[model samples]
Target: MRCVVLPGVYPPQEDTLLLAAALRRERLPPAARVLDVGTGSGALAVAAARHGAAEVTAVDVCGRAVLTARLNGLLAGCRIRTVRGDLLCPVAGERFDLVVANPPYVPTPPAPRPSRGIARTSDGGEDGRTVLDRLCAEVPAALRPSGVLLLVHSALCGVRPTLALLAAAGLRAEVADRALVPLGPETRSRAGWLLRRGLLAPGQEKEELVVIRAERV
Candidate 1:
């Protein structure tokens, strides 16, 4: 797909493609509403639109990301409503048939998350569930009954907890997909901290990526 990714906006990566593939497997109604949270370049939004979602909305906190997603949607010839705000904040009181997210799941040290810059795209709190947890908690409210949520994150962040949270939110959740990928730049930079925290073993260079599928039943 042709996409315009500006500086500081995240480019499509493994997790993005994984979530997109999982998205295609979903059975979307003809006029289904789709929400792509933390949509970096609108790749998943475009995919959802292409797969028959009548209304697709992409949300991001970064200005560059918002522009990039809008541009990519235009370039892809898909109609995507792009909004700039924190995850799910812009779409209050709205509901969707499908919600997709590939949020920041990298385990960084506990500290105030960056308010701007590229770091904001990948910095998750200490255990790496900062954004993931919030998404799991808030997304259920945005999902219509029988709606589905597809989220991608690293196994290092703990898949079971995510499942538990989603289940606690009344969604029937399960691991839909998994893949082992080599650590990227951000993960490599935090290798020492991760090792010290016992989140990673010495010489470990790969992490498992997991896609959690939850349905509001």
Candidate 2:
């Protein structure tokens, strides 16, 4: 069986694992220079390398996640450069032909599992716009002209609002792909948590997983 990524230092979540599976089923164009932001388990990064991306840089905010990405790269026999810093922080002055982010878009508090690395922002923080705001701003600088940016995140994390933010950041955005999947345990629990805080609908967890595609203008 072909795996999207060989096992990494940190176990991959179901969505990311599924994302890799989906990517493997597609054929990217030639000489793609790829960057995988928030690269927790290095699944997408390794996928780019294994499938022949000319350049691959995998970065994450968590120090441990970097180690995991490195280990995963090694185990998979793919030479991916792993860095530690907050979204695009380590790669300042660098650019890529394709940028991928599975950010902490989960609109949850800081109580999420430290090791899951889902990229949760502050307290689901007022319409869940925290991390997406930063990412929308940061992505354009890193994207090469004609480069594509792919962001995988949730509907409840405010995809519409995020699209607006991306436009304000001077990037053209579209929903290139979408999926409906089981919310992770923490995201599933967001209903009660948000309700206690006087937010959320009864069935908000049945949310869309959007793949926001972007390009530098």
Candidate 3:
């Protein structure tokens, strides 16, 4: 699908593609309600809409991302509701048949989150679970009975913790797909820090990105 990604907005990458593939495997009824949290460029939202989802709501905290997503949706010929808010805030009190997210999961040094620039798109705090943890914790509240969430993050963030968190949140969660890709520039620059944090082994250059499927049971 064609998408217009502004400079500050994250462009679709491998993780996005993986999530889209996983989304295709799900059975989205024609009237299914879908939500794409952190919908960078609205790729997943449009994909969900194209896959027969009747309604798609996309949320992002970045103003540029919100506009970019809206434009991308128009370009893709899908009607997507784009909202600007952190994580699930914009969709409060709403339940969705399907939820998708590709939140920041990179293990970065402890520091105040940047107000503008690429850090906001990739930094996920020390353990790389800052954003992911919140997503796992709050998703249960937004998911209808039997609704599914498709989330993607790197294994460096600890996949088991994510699973345990979702399980504790009353959702049945498991890794549905995985891809071993070379570390990107950001990760490569933090190689030493990741090594010190025991997240990356010595000489380890590849990271496994996992697509997790969690269902409200």
Estimate TM-scores for all models.
Answer: 0.98, 0.81, 0.97
Instruction: Estimate, for each residue in 155-186, the C-alpha lDDT of model 2 and write its tens digit.
Output: 77667877887888778988877888776766
Model 3 misplaced stretches (Cα beyond 4 Å) = none
Pairing residues by index, what is the TM-score of model 1? 0.98
What ranking emerges by lDDT with the best candidate at the front? 1, 3, 2
Error of 2 at 140 (Å): 0.4
Clashing pairs in 1: none
Candidate 1: worst 10 consecutive residues by lDDT?
Answer: 111-120
Q: How far out, in Å, is residue 182 in model 2?
A: 1.5
lDDT (CA) for every model shown? 0.94, 0.71, 0.92
- 151-174: candidate 1 lDDT, tens digit per residue: 999999999999999999999999
In terms of lDDT, the best-performing candidate is: 1
Which lDDT tens digits does candidate 3 get at residues 1-217?
Answer: 7678899888999999999999999997658999999998899999999899999999999999999999989998889999999999888999999999999999999888888767789999888999999998899999988999999999998999999999999999999999999898789988998899888999997999999999999
Worst 10 residues of 3 by lDDT: 111-120
Q: Clashes in model 2: which pairs?
A: 104-119, 107-124
